[model samples]
Target: MPVRTADAALAGVRRGVGAERLTGRTALVTGSSRGMGRAAAIRLAQEGALVAVHYNRDEAAAREVVTSVEKDGGRAFAVRGELGVDGDVDGLFAVLEEDLRERTGSTDLHILVNNAGVMGGVGADEVTPEQFDRIFAVNAKAPFFLIQRALRNMPDGGRIINISSGLTRFANPDEIAYAMSKGALEQLALHFAKALGPRRITINSVAPGITRNGNPVFDIPEVVEQMAGLSAFGRVGEPEDVADVVAFLATDEARWITGSFVDATGGTLLG
Candidate 1:
């Protein structure tokens, strides 16, 4: 079988012609220039949400996402900010708010997806203090503060979704640092769900396992088949597989669901 791209995974979903469940709402998805973030941004836009595509440095790729959204009659623009750095969250919202206000006459964000993360591929012994710090800073600290800042303008009935990892539940020695970072991320949803409940703003964490993310390894059939076996369905998880779940959480129908860690891992390691 041939390798499948993210777009191919979304082929079945009707774009520019759907329920428009998120009409008039505004969403910001970080690290959306590629992979699952890109898929979520598109999926939300398909449901009629004006999306802000955030990227660290890939302006060209970000533009491509914006273009793709606009081509389908959806509204989208790109914003850039490197996570894990001082003033990263502040700088990101500065641009995001300005663009939002200019377009909709309001700075209220309806959905926030904390998806940008770094995977420090090092075992426990080989991982350095600096490596651990950076990983936590990006995967944990940044999302924590991003939510803090987003609350300033996020209206009641808003949605906040953080992209976690299956490594938190399963074990991967080489990804110990990365998994720990995601574990910290999961804690955010657990506590915030209660805190934000009164305001009707839902917060949840989504954990995906062994997803195909445009990595060259996925291009090789042998590697693909081996990884496919990890899933109960005998297939690798697609970006859309995870994005569809994020999109559902952002809808009004999910108002009662909060502070949950959704397993988007395709039942990985369920044997």
Candidate 2:
């Protein structure tokens, strides 16, 4: 058979045999009001998992995501939470627990995607202690505690996917604090995988390169073009690109894949 034809056949087989992969599963995706998080939540729901659409401050945006998911015949609801704060995290869980009970009569969660993050690059000299602390609180500490809370409600075969960045591998001179925070997240994935292995829970990280959203960084045509050039694919990635991988990870098809960092970076880390 031709290579392309053979590849197509294999893909069909995988899809057909994947066991209704994520059907009846429940997922939580933080920072899902827009961008990558929103894409991931929708993808997971499309793949048959009930999704919890999480947002920090954008209630309307979060509701919009939920509405879109439901319109597509998927299960989803907006849940508000501030990633870097304790009270907000606790309250988020409380609401999630209640929602879960109403929907499925169970508090168990199957997948947790730590997709919330903030990016602000400052020179080392300009980085203040407060700035560093906030970055860590959101990018590192929040995920840690969220994972801890998730594991309590997750059963065997559950998954935890942390969203990291390419900066962890390549140095960005101006992103001192942001890079450091992602580095910490990378470590958390490895250690959490080990810690959760006994329960058959898998933990991993998905690191992305510069991608366009409504963010100002990608607003300039020249800057967008420059970002595309950084990748071997010669194009910046789309939210859907990252979402596809995350949806797969949440399925039983990836049960054996754990403690790994999957690069959805459009080959930006490639030399």
Candidate 3:
């Protein structure tokens, strides 16, 4: 279908979403209080989904995200639960159900964005059992179990996007545990793609490379240039860069894509 004119394109786009791009859908983006997850939550709301902004300890930040969404004339709410702890998933969903039902009259989730994760804990040689377990607990175990619980409420044609990293595809010894956990998460997507195909549910991983998620490391000019030089575009990624890919996956336009690793790396793998 060729889009003819500017006005026609605008009309077509508005019609596609019935309001924006994800209207009548409900999305829950974890770790949404800040960073890439926060960008995804806001993007989903802009596209017309009723967003559940999940946070760990920053209620103010979470509420701020909700406020931002509402300020843009979108609907959103906050759900708080610290991941990587026992009964964490249960507590997360308890808040999700009560809050979601109160707003939308149903607890069904159409999109689940597993963006909450941990990066650094300890170097491998200095890695203790507690360190390893905590890494996997937050990065791997939390998403694994969160999906298990979300499946009961997620209906057919639901979308599950796991936020992965470019490190999994390359050799990065510094973040070994973090990369391994993301690898495990990709495997979950591969296996579940077939497992959930019968239900028309799509699961995929979006791997980002050297993203500028408001970290102070990028604040240094030399560090910023060094990171940007790694990409073929000679630029680092922004939170919205990854969030755009994730937002596309949440829509019906990406229905054909599943069980794949989307490289949102700006050509960082071109070596």
All candidates: TM-score: 0.95, 0.91, 0.92
Clashes of 3: 0
Ranking by lDDT: 1, 3, 2
Regions of model 1 farther than 4 Å from truth: 1-16
> Which lDDT tens digits does candidate 1 get at residues 67-109?
9999988899999999999999999999999999999999999
Residue pairs in collision within model 3: none
- Candidate 2 residues lying further than 4 Å off, grouped into runs, are 1-20
**lDDT value for model 1:** 0.92
Highest TM-score: give the candidate number.
Answer: 1
Question: What are the Cα lDDT values of the candidates?
Answer: 0.92, 0.83, 0.87
Considering every candidate listed, which one attains the maximal lDDT? 1
1-271: candidate 3 lDDT, tens digit per residue: 2211122333323222334778889999999999999989988888899999999989999999999989878899999999999999999999899998999999999999999998864567877778788889999999999999999999899999999989898877778898999999888899999999999999999999988777788788777777787787777777777888999999899999899999998899697
TM-score of 2: 0.91
Q: Between 1 and 2, whose TM-score is larger?
A: 1
Ranking by TM-score: 1, 3, 2
Clashing pairs in 1: none
